[model samples]
Target: MLSNTTPSGRDVLLPMFFIGLMFFILGFVTWLNGSLIPFLKIVCELSNFQALWVAFAFYIAYTVMALPSAAILARTGYKRGMTIALGVMAMGALLFIPAARTGLYPIFLIALFTLASGMTLMQTAINPYIVCIGPRESAALRISIMGLFNKGAGIVVPLVFTALILSGMEHVSEASLGALDAAAREAMRNDLSQRLVFPYAVMAGALLLFMGLIHVSSLREPVLDAADAPADAAPRQGLLQHPQLVLGAITLFGYVGVEVIAGDTIALYGHQLGVAHYGVLTSYTMGFMVLGYALGVLLIPRWLSQRAALAWSAGSGLLFALGVALGSSGESTWSQALLGWAGVPAVPDTVLCLALLGLSNALVWPAVWPLALEGLGKHTAAGSALLIMAISGGALLPMLYGHLADVSGPQRAYWVLLPWYALILFYALAGSRLRRWSVA
Candidate 1:
């Protein structure tokens, strides 16, 4: 709902570049939870159900705070909204210091929630801001470039955590886990907690500094003349009427669920499957994500349409899930290299499955957004906020995944994606056809 006061210019790329950098940071910070879930679960001695609250607290903030974010944008406009969001994010990062010091699981979840609330606001401002900065036809490519930065951070943050947390110590056996004498365990816990102190402190300082930089930057506001506004102002209509848009939202929701499941769950899932070190899969999965985005940046609109891209992506997901599940259940060499290890391969095969999942995920998000908001002019921002609310799937679906992991084990829990993927495939093939229904 934020409006800009300045004219669009030829050099929009620089500002978009900086914006992409901030998004990269956001993605880095956001996806690090994938690593933290398993790490903190071990350090905090959590049950599968309890540990997954890491995602629940973080992503549910979007459902809670997105409307408020829309309200803030309407008031402060985009530039000031971003500044406020960065400042709040800095405060959230600082909370991690104390949360780490206490080694209390709930406090860490609270800190993550606080942090995610800030991201919710930032995402609300950022995604549309990127779109309005350029021509709509090329939006996916630009967003894909920005996504490269985002998923690129997802690759890096886990590597950093691995070096700092996992690799630095000896691999603790399940037999020895949570069995330390009280004083030793407490000391180990405190030491482990303090590791977060410096990283988060540095992040807080960076966010504050970024806030100042954005305040001083030469970013231009979008110049929307009256001619560009929506053609219609009808107040109440069914989203079902806008089937493509509805389908787009559904696609986005399902895409986020599977992507989070693939990324965040990989570490825990790997551990359960007897992969001794799961940190390595974090970077590998994100590498596939980056590759997918890079491919999208190249192929979309030029060689392929967004709808076509989404369909292929969904199909890849279905195939990859089937390969992983079937391979795990059977004992073929392909299954060993692709799903498990030894003569059976664990890390490599699981990584391959996750990587393939990432590839399938790459196009769904970038393509879905623009297609969803295609014709809704004034309602565009509201519709965007609604889709942003749907990102709450990042929170809820993962909990369901964690519960499934708890009940039937990680590999079996992957059955969760079947329904999610089916919905998306339906949207891509049929839901996009709803554009014919809109008369306005």
Candidate 2:
């Protein structure tokens, strides 16, 4: 049985490499929203709520486009859909050039929507591809490898944006702006805004170039089929009956919601604690998450099973969130140590909480997929799209948290993540079971 169950390791590597490249782009774009939030607020003069629409615009694209992407994949196959996603990302990046020139936040959001819509296409295509590329026992391991590229990008995105934006902001302090005449201030804003031009232009060029590479690449196009057709058939029909898929969608929804909240809200949390330079809080939070991802690369399927890793992570996240809530309530020293150690320049405690949240978040996506897609052969593509659509939780939940923050304060609003982590814990337990409802 062991001999018969061996993985086709070599056959899966090259395709996985290209798939990992797409995941890298996903992480880079998603995590860069951290920088975009503050950058847009300064450049476009947006309120906190308005700036957060950066996340809303980008993640909501998944909800709007997932079904459409699935349809395209159903018709066109994975390789072509990936190529189209790349092309669309290029278009989205190009829109930034003009939006930057005019200092128009709404146009920037439109550009984000285009970019996210493209990612919606890419995610819808690639997730199932990762699962299908290997034996069931090692599917999570392969996806974890895919995630190393994804999280590796997360690690770098903020540093890149910091190099781009922080230095520019140094030129526009209160004193500098105060000294400038009205016209000069306007000129300064325009000049600072234009800094976005070159970065986005380069991103557009890379995206377009990747599109060409994908167009000519030899990646296989996996397709959805009836469950009984072949051992490797994509489960098209029994998907409706699959308990794991249903529960996994809920799990993904909760994971993205909390993950977004942890990363996106921490900067504001730092500000509430009277921490200056809250602008960079998001980057530090990603560092925490990347640390966890690094561990995932080293340990998954070696010293840890994905389910075991997820359960442990989720439990730790719940504990960390509790610590954050307590620290925010006036226990500043503990919170300071938590946040500061992660290199966040603000109230160190808040940064620490956010970083610890990253450890909890680490195994979520990689763990959730294999459990969800365990037996989904023909239905893997559609099921994965449903799971992708659930990512709209990131778009909607943060907006809800924003409203709560406005009314209650950023720290108080963290109460929401308690239940979010609870749901994640549920999935790690019985929710991951493949046939929770079946008579079999």
Cα-based TM-score, every candidate: 0.90, 0.88
lDDT of 2 by residue, 1-440 (tens): 11233436655777888998999998888888876776676666655677789889999999999878988876677789899999999999999999999998889999999999999999987887777666666666777777778777877876777787666464444446668788987887788889889999999999999899999988766533354112223454556688888888888888898899888777556655645565566766676777777788788788988888889888998998887766644445764555558654435664577667977897798888888877765566677778899899899888887778778877777777888788888888888885758665
C-alpha lDDT (0 to 100) for residue 230 of candidate 2: 26
TM-score of 1: 0.90
Give lDDT tens digits, candidate 1, residues 22-137: 88879988888888888787778877778889988988898899878887877777778888989988988999998998998888988888888888888887887777666677
Q: Candidate 2's error at 102, in angstroms?
A: 1.8
Worst 10-residue lDDT window for candidate 1 reads 225-234
Clash totals for all candidate models: 6, 15
lDDT of 1: 0.77
lDDT of each: 0.77, 0.77
